[model samples]
Every structure is written in C-alpha cells, then in structure tokens.
Target: MPRQTILGIESSANKVGVGIVTDDELIANTRATFHGAPGEGFRPTEVARHHQKILPELIEAALNQAGISESSDVTAIAYTRGPGMGAPLQAGAVAAQTLALSFGVPLVPVNHCVAHVEMGRSVTKSANPVVLYVSGGNTQILTYARNKYYILGETLDIAVGNCFDRLARVLKLPNEPSPGYSVEQEAKSGTKLFPLSYSVKGMDMSFSGILTQITAQGKKLMNGKDTRWSKADLCMSLQETVFAMLVETTERAISVANLNTVLIVGGVGCNKRLQEMMRIMCAERGAELGATDARYCIDNGAMVAHTAALMYQHGVHINPYSGADYTQRYRTDDVNVVWRNDVLT
Candidate 1:
C-alpha cells in the first residue's frame, strides 16, 4: 500500500501550527505564536488575525519542509476543529476548509483534547493508558473504556496552567518563551513554601482560589509588603500546591481504573516538575508512565495530523465545505473514538 500523508492545521490558541505526517512518520511541524506583552493576555480577535496572516505561509513552509508538492502529495487535510478560542478556531477551520477544497481531499475534523491523547499514545506506544491532560484551559484525567475517553476527574474551576499564567502576569513575567516556563525557572531558587488554598473536592480540583490568593500575594510582594517570601517562593508554592492536587486525582483514577500506564498530554504536560511527580506516583504504584517529546506535548499540528489521519484511515470524516464547523466548548468525551476498539482492560 502507498504511504498516506496528511496536512494538519492547529490554531486553537495563540499558536498557529502547521504539520505534515506520513502514516509511519512525522515529516514537518511548523508553528507561529502571538505573544502579548508582560501582564497582558491574548485577545481572540488579534489571535485570529495573526492566524489568518501566517497560515498561508506556514502551510507552504510545512509542505516545503516535507519535500512534497502541494498538488498531489497529501492524502487528506486535518485540523483542530474545536475546544478552543472561538475566533482562532474559526480562522483555522476556514483555512482548513479552503485548503481541503483546493487540494480536493477529505477533511478530518478532530477534537483538540482527543488529538493530544492520541498523539501521546501514538508517540509513546502506550496502549490503553490513563491520560492526565493538563493545559492552559483544561485539566482532566481521562481513560479509554467501552470506546470512549472517560473523564475520571477534572478541574472544577480554573485550570492549573491558567492559574500559573495569571500569577505570572501579576509578577510582570515575560511571555516570550512561556510564562509557565519562566515561573518554573524562578522556582528553582525557592526555599519557603507560602500558604495557598488547595481545593480538591473528592476527585476533581479547583484552582480559582489558589490563583486569586497567589495574585494578591504577588501584588503585595511587588509593593514591598512581604519581603521574606520572594517571587521564587510563591512560584514554587504554587507548583507544589497545584501539582499535588493533579497527582492525587490522577492516582485515584489510576487506582479505580486499575490501569498500569499513565500518559500525560497537553501544554502543561511538558513541565518537568509535573512529569517527575507523575513518574514518582506511577513508580510507587508499580505502573509505567508515558510522555511524548517536549515539542509534541504542547499544541501542534502534528498531533492533530496524526489523530485525524487515524480517523481518516478508519473512515471517519466530514465535508470540508459544509459540515466543518469549530466549537469553543467541545468536550473531550464528546468525540467518538471510531478508530480504536474498546479496550478490555
């Protein structure tokens, strides 16, 4: 059989990514991000415009990187169809629709969260693992059973990454590389743990209070009120408090599911501290942990391409011109896993 190749578009947030993947290998992954100044956040309209401006060049670049002709190289077009900022999602969907029509190929619409998990599983080769999906806008424990990715537990309020980024904003941290990464770097010198609310209700967690308290403390620190507790201490404390909740919820899910493997996905999944904590928990339970490369952990077109390729190969598709629409509130469990059989374990 001839190798199958797919072009994927991902513009769910500030990042606009383009990727190409063959059946067995990833060929090219390109991305452009809209970076706001310190203490500033992304606006949907600006992000959408950024995507619109860069997508055409990015698509050409990705195709060029893959060493293929745009006319007849790709088998299908894939895109992050939902679970993202409305404007950004719409921009990517429209672009995907246009590209699919221009290329005369089937369009595969993919759920963003499921694409993350599928990419993790594909890269790590971890079959039927419990997934801890933590990102800027999401935090959930997921596992596959009966042909669906069941949500074991999730954030009841703000997501962990959002909390970190908000705190970073209060501290006037740079958003160049990433606010979370900056927080992590600053946390290395932290020696004291500040008191912050930890809201873990049964299995689900909440970070709203944590974020609020941390932001206040950060303001006070900026005003020279709490000189004893440095910014590093606050960052360290935030990570400790939040990641503990995540680990606890994930462990509970693991115990309940009786699964031996845990896979971490999404932007926050690239955090070294989080990965270490999950690994420690998995080790104690005599289980294994699965994680993708740091690059793949974050939102990218490759993951979307890989996932949509699986669905496209499995006969799942939608009309690019008419039926393809993006959703801002798409749930991970809402996607039907038609590509995989129900796992017995």
Candidate 2:
C-alpha cells in the first residue's frame, strides 16, 4: 500500500499548526504561535495581520519538516475551514486549497471542533462516547446522532477556554502560553481557599460569572482579612471552581445521553485536574472515560490532518476552496459525521 500523506494547516487561533499525516499517524507538526502585538489575548485584526505575514513561512516550514519537496508528494491537503475568525480561517483555507490544486489532489475542509473529537477516537479507539469540546472558540457536548454531530448542549455565553484565558489576562497572567496551562501550573502548588460559582444548566453550561468571581476572589484574598493567602491558593480555587462546572455538566450530559463512555477533547483537556476529575466521575459512575494525552489533546495540526484524512476517506469533502471562505461561526452541528464507513472515501 502506498503511503497517503496529508498536509494540515491550522490557523484558527494564535497557534498555526502545520502537520503531515498518513491517515491517523502523525508525521510532523510545527506550530507558529502568534500573540497580541501590544496587549493581551486576541486582537482579531492583529492576528489576521500576523497570519498574512507568517502563514507563508509556516507553510514552507511544515513542508520542509515533512521532507516533502512538492505538493504533488502529498496524497491530500486538509485544512481547517471554519468555526474560527474569518480572516484566520481563510488564511489556511487559501494555502491548503492552493496546495491541493498544485498537486491536483482532493481538498478536505475540516471542522475545528469535529477535528478535536476525532483526535480522541484516533488515539483511544473509543466507540459511542460523549464528547466534550472545550476550546477558545467552542464549548460543546457532541455525539453522533442521526448521521450528524449532535449538539447535546453548549455555552449559553462564553466558551470555557476563552473565559479562562480572559480571566488569566485579567489577573495579569502572561500571554506567552494559554491561561489554562498557567492556571493548571499554578494550581499545583496553590491551596484552594475560596468558593466560587459553578453553573451547569441541564446539558449546557456558563463560566463568565465564575471567572469574574475568581478574579474578585483573588483580589479579596490579596487585600482582605486574609491578606496572606498564597497566589497558588487563588489559582487552585479558580481551577477547582471551573473544573467542577465542566465535570458536573459533562456528567449530567453523560447520564442524559445514557452513554457509558466519555471522550474529553479540545485544548482545555490539557489540564491534569480536568482529566483527573473527569476520571473520578466516570469511575464512580462505572462509565469509561477517554481523554487524549497532552500531545494529542491540544489543538495541533495533527488532529486537523487526521480528521481531514478521515473525512476524505469517508467521502465527506468540499472543493474549489482556493477562494474558500472562513467561518466565524462554525458549530458542531454544521455537518453529519459519517464514522468508519467505506463510502466516506
């Protein structure tokens, strides 16, 4: 069997993930991180500007790292098509579509959230697990139903990961890496001393109030009766409060769905506490939990490439994406998921 190489480009957010994959096997993933020019978090227009400047170079680097000289070497070109900023999404779409045309191969447009879910299946080989996608731009509980990625529930407000990042910036955390990682790192040594809000309604959830409460809690700890509270304590409390909401909501979703397995996807799954907490919940309920390891958990080109190849192999693909537009509002229910079917190819 000839090797099928897929080139994946992910510029949905600050990190541009470029990867080459043969089916679900990863070849090389190169990430180019871009941050706000002068402030914190994302300045969409600024990221768009940065994308234009760095995208070409990053694409070249991905191809170089894959040791492929020409686009013709790739069996297919898969790119994240939507559920992100229009400018950023189009950036990768244009690049990928061009590569596909230059190689005269097929183009596969991947949904960012679905790609995240696919990462778990590629690794854990779980069947029929409830999916929890927590990322900067998305908060969704997905399961395949009636041939589509069914949306069990989602954020009525801000995304969990975005809420964390924004809260981190509010606490003056560094933007070098995401606040989720920072919060997790800080929680390691911090004692959770405050009680924060947790709201998970039905299968849906919200986190903005809790984030604000944590920030205020931190401020009170710094200036209140207990002025000696450690920063670790603050981070720990925040992590706990947030993780609790996630766990509670996911558990509720699992029970409602009547599924015995859970798959934790998206960048926020990088949190050890989240994994552990979810593990405990699944254990107590006698349900299996499928959470991708750090490498496969975070948003990377590998997931995008892996998902795109799967989409192509499943025959769920689009074409003429050279002028392919970006989708600022890509939802999980945008397309039906055709799992493990030969007709997909």
Top-scoring candidate (lDDT) = 1
Overall local distance difference test of candidate 2 = 0.77
True lDDT of residue 27, candidate 1: 96
lDDT of 1 at 312: 84
Q: What are the per-residue Cα lDDT tens digits for candidate 1 across 112-180?
A: 999999999988889889899999999999988777899999998878889888988989888977888
List candidate 2 stretches off by more than 4 Å. 1-3, 37-39, 218-230, 340-345
Highest-scoring model, TM-score = 1
RMSD of each: 1.1, 3.2
Question: What TM-score goes with each of the models?
Answer: 0.98, 0.89
Candidate 2 weakest ten by summed lDDT = 336-345
- Note the Cα lDDT for every prediction shown: 0.90, 0.77
